[model samples]
Structure formats: C-alpha cells, structure tokens
Target: MSKQPPLDKFERDVLDESVPIQQLLRLVIVLGGRAFSEPLRLWARNELQGYPGPGIPLPTYRMITAPLQMDSHSRFSQGRNETISALALPDVAHDLVSEQLPVTFSVGKLQNLISHQDPHTPLKLGLPGSAELARLMTSERSGQGVVVERIYWSVHASALHDILEQVRNRLLEFVAELRATMEPGESEPTVGQVHQAAQTINITVGDHSPVHVIAPHRHSATVSFPTRPHHRWWPRR
Candidate 1:
C-alpha cells in the first residue's frame, strides 16, 4: 500500500515570491505532503529556539504569516475612478465566535502550518530604492502634504521569456482578433498605448489574508530569522 505523505519544511521569502496564491496550490500540496512523509521533529524543535516548548508536532502545527501594505489609486479600478484600499493579501480565515477555525477545519495542524496566499500580485520585492520611486519618507510630512509615488516591479528577467512567450501566443491573438472588429477608420493602439497595458494572464488566488496561501496550498514554514532585516517595510526615518 502507498504510505501517507510526510510533513516538510518551507521558507518564507522563496515561497512568497514564487508561489503565494490560490492558483499555485501545488506548493502547499507538495510541502504538506513532504511534511507528512518526512521526519521533521528536530526542525520543529529548533523553531522553538527562543522559548523551549516540547517539540511541536510536525503534522499538528501550522503557521500563517504575511505582511502587507495598502495603497489607493485612481487607475487601478475599471474606470479612472475612486481611490480604494485593497489588501495585498487577505488575513487568515477565522470563526467569528471562538475566533478559531470552523470545527471541520483541522485545528491541531492549523497553527503549526504556515501558509500565505494573496488575491493580487505579490508586492514588489527587491533593493529598496531601485524598485521604489520614492525611497525617503519623513514623519514630519505624515498628516499633511501629498505625495505621488510609483514603485516599479518585475519578474525575473530569465523567466520573463517563458511567460511572455505564452502571452504572445494567447493574449496577442485575442487583441488582434478584437482589433479586426474595430471600425475601418479606427487607428491601431500606439506603441505607448500597447506598452502601458497590464497582463491578461493573471493568477487568481484566495482571500486577502496575510497567510502565504490559497485555500489548499500552504506556503513553506521554513524560515530564516536573519540577523539583519532583509527589507523593513517602513524603516525609522
């Protein structure tokens, strides 16, 4: 008979970047499967470095961690419309009463498992100033003046080719078909018009919860409590 899967370890940064969404549910399945089939008692023991607790059960524990920033933009919605705040990733699902999981969800493994998923694109991650239009923020300007900001982001250059190739095959065709239906006198979109467009192939996922996860896909629980803050969201001015 095939044996049950073992539990596995997961890292935050890698998983969040590469696989945080409901669509990429494979990540959670693979890791959780590994956790079930692998031996992870020592690793769980080590996670409790600060406070010594009896080793956390590999299958019974869960950890959900996510940090997000909210922004308002006019161009974000369908129209050049109202400014709205959307969660980069939603929060963990909760029961209104005990503030716990529904009785049906596995409670023992819930906290021990660490999963993070988002409905939108992953927040831009990289060297601070390079990705952000404005690097400096003064608390002195907190309540008052306006600031127009832009943060540029990108997927890995090497990987871009494959995804772009898919886009070329799919979305490009759709656009061409649509253009043909336009009025005979209509002009084609200019270079700038086409260049400014967003992706047609988007990976949809679960709620906005901060957890790096979709419903079934849980991100890795592996962590590196590095001595330095790799990237602090809002560093002290």
Candidate 2:
C-alpha cells in the first residue's frame, strides 16, 4: 500500500490561507481588470503601487517553482532549490506586505466553511477582523451594509463553493501531470534504490509573497497560496 502523507505544520497553514483567497477570488477577483471603475483606478493610480493583496478588483497570480532533484544520484541533486509565485488583484495591505499573507488560517477557514451548509441560506460569511473572526461561525449574509443580519448559511452556499471546485479541477492538472512522469526534486521509486524516501515536504503558500485582490468601494481581505517545499531526492549535483 502507498504510504499516507503526514499531517505537517504547513498543511494547516496552506488550508488556512486558502480560505480568504477563496473568498477574495469569488467576491473581489472578478472576471476582468476592466471590472473596476476607471475613476477609482485613477484615484488610486499614482498612490496605488502594485501589490499582491486587495485593491485593483480583478487580477491574476502565478505559482512558480523549480524543484531540484532530491535523489543523491540525480544531476541537479545538490542542496539547491527555487520557488516562484504570482498574484492576481492586489490590496493596500498586500501592497505594504507584498506577498506575505497568512497561510494557516485561509485554508482552514475555507475547508470548515465549505464542508457544511444549510439548505436555506445566503451563504453566510463571518465578518473579518472582529470577534466573529474568533467565533469562526457559519452565518448567512442577510440585510445590507448598515443593517446586516447574520443568518445561518447552508443551502445557498454555492458562491464560495466554486473556488474549491476550481481548486479540484486545478488539482487534477497536478495529478495528471505527475501521474505519468518523474517529478522534480523527486526520485523514481525502486525496489533496490533505497529503502527510505523523504519524510518531510515544505509548502510555502505564495512563496514569500501572498496573493492579493483589490476593490473600489469595499476593502478586500485577500489571500492566495502555492503548495511549496515539495521535496524528494534526485542526484548529487
């Protein structure tokens, strides 16, 4: 039987970070760069530098990595590694911090929120940066800005639901690509090669940078991450 992957610290961080990203992607990261009002862009233009967080409305991100071989016998198997990431939309906070968004919370919150749902709700969402952030409760979005009411969200939780759906589809690409070929920083499993394989892998969400999104009227709390530190052995280069 194939050995099960271990639950590591990064696993928790990645899941945590993916939550807000899922939200930002759904709400702020819209269909196009032109989604933002031109006036807003102009206002924020000179003052608005490029960033990874929320600010611009719609943008794109990239996760770049050049995994070095881990096998002691592989060519580029020396102790060198590289990683790259890109962000879509951006925010002020993300601009100040660039790509350093929290990873542990985004993924965790997203998974918890998506797994369960009520059949009659408006996809309840807890407000960010408040006592609610602590509660982490699943509530519905009722009423509006000034008089918003918190209802339990369940049945109508289809909004953020698609992000994970996208994630799954994207994950298929990973599975598909790796299914037939040897992965970087990876060694082909061989009965006589070695009795042991790497026991630890590192996943840096967005690498040293965090993905951000931008909006005109509302401030966007954004998040984006890339699976990092995927380690294996290649050669002794």
Question: Per-residue lDDT tens digits of candidate 2, residues 1-237?
Answer: 864332122233324544443432322122113333232222123112222243323211222111111111123232211111212111211232222222212333445656675635334322123233112211221121121122111223344454344443432332233223433444222211111111010111333432222334422211112122212222111
lDDT of 2 at 87: 24
lDDT of 1 by residue, 63-177 (tens): 2122222232233332221222222111210111111111111211221222231323332322233223232321222354423243223222222223223323323332443
Query: Candidate 1 lDDT (Cα, whole model)?
Result: 0.26
Instruction: Output the number of the lDDT-best candidate.
Output: 2
TM-score, every prediction = 0.16, 0.26
Top-TM-score candidate index:
2
Give residue 189's error in model 2 in angstroms.
10
Task: Evaluate candidate 1 by giving its C-alpha RMSD to the native, one decimal.
Answer: 23.2
